[model samples]
Target: MNKLLLTLGFVLIPLLVIFALFMTNSVETQITLMCVALVTAIIIGFKAEAFKYDYTTFLFFLYLASFLGILCLIQFLFHVL
Candidate 1:
């Protein structure tokens, strides 16, 4: 179940981004959806250790999530004020 959810999360991340881009016109809504997906990915990455995944891979995911999260914050700020 964990592996399945992890796999589904990875798949859904991109799908959520695409959906946010094409389906939503509001910048805030798009950013909100993206942040939600990124947070989910981060959670799954943290859980990967139980499945014996590599530490380096988890760090990489963490790095990517942080970077994207920062970008989302900036975008939100710009969109808002």
Candidate 2:
């Protein structure tokens, strides 16, 4: 359960943040997400350490890759229509 929560924490938080950003009409979406990313990184880092996990940096980037891959897939599907 701990691992699952950690995984979801690292994955969903940023996506949720970005989704929130999309709801706004701000012209600085990139900057907003960047700030959200930094805050979420701190949160994930601290939580991972609290659970005595290792290879945090590796896992972060791996999660990021998976997230981006999903985003690309979604974009491709949209464009294919």
Candidate 3:
């Protein structure tokens, strides 16, 4: 149960932050947040030992990194084209 809660927290906290950023209705802020999330995922992926062996934890960060990568790409396309 404790592990479950911790997993939920890893998912929910970012979702909540994204929710708040969406509420602001600022594209720049959203893009910035995405970049930050992507970097954070990378840092955590390398520095966190648990991510090395824990599949669930690895998936969570992988999901975060990929999702943020997509968002950043879309934002880049929007600005360039």
Highest lDDT among the candidates is held by which one?
Answer: 1
Q: Candidate 2: list runs displaced more than 4 Å.
A: 50-53, 56-81
- Give the distance in Å from residue 10's predicted Cα in candidate 1 to where it truly belongs: 0.8
Question: Clash number for every model?
Answer: 0, 0, 0
Model 3 C-alpha lDDT per residue in residues 1-76, reported as the tens digit of each score: 5455455545654875576356646667777666665555545455545566678877876776676767667766
C-alpha lDDT of residue 64 in model 3: 69
TM-score of 2: 0.41
- Which is the better candidate, 2 or 3, if ranked by TM-score? 3
| Model 1 C-alpha lDDT per residue in residues 1-81, reported as the tens digit of each score | 777877877898889877876788787888788888877877775665433656676676677677667766776687779
Worst 10 residues of 3 by lDDT: 1-10
User: Which runs of model 3 end up more than 4 angstroms from their true locations?
Assistant: 1-8, 11-17, 35-52
lDDT of 1 at 68: 65
lDDT ranking, high to low:
1, 3, 2
lDDT of each: 0.74, 0.58, 0.62
Q: Is candidate 2 or candidate 3 better by lDDT?
A: 3
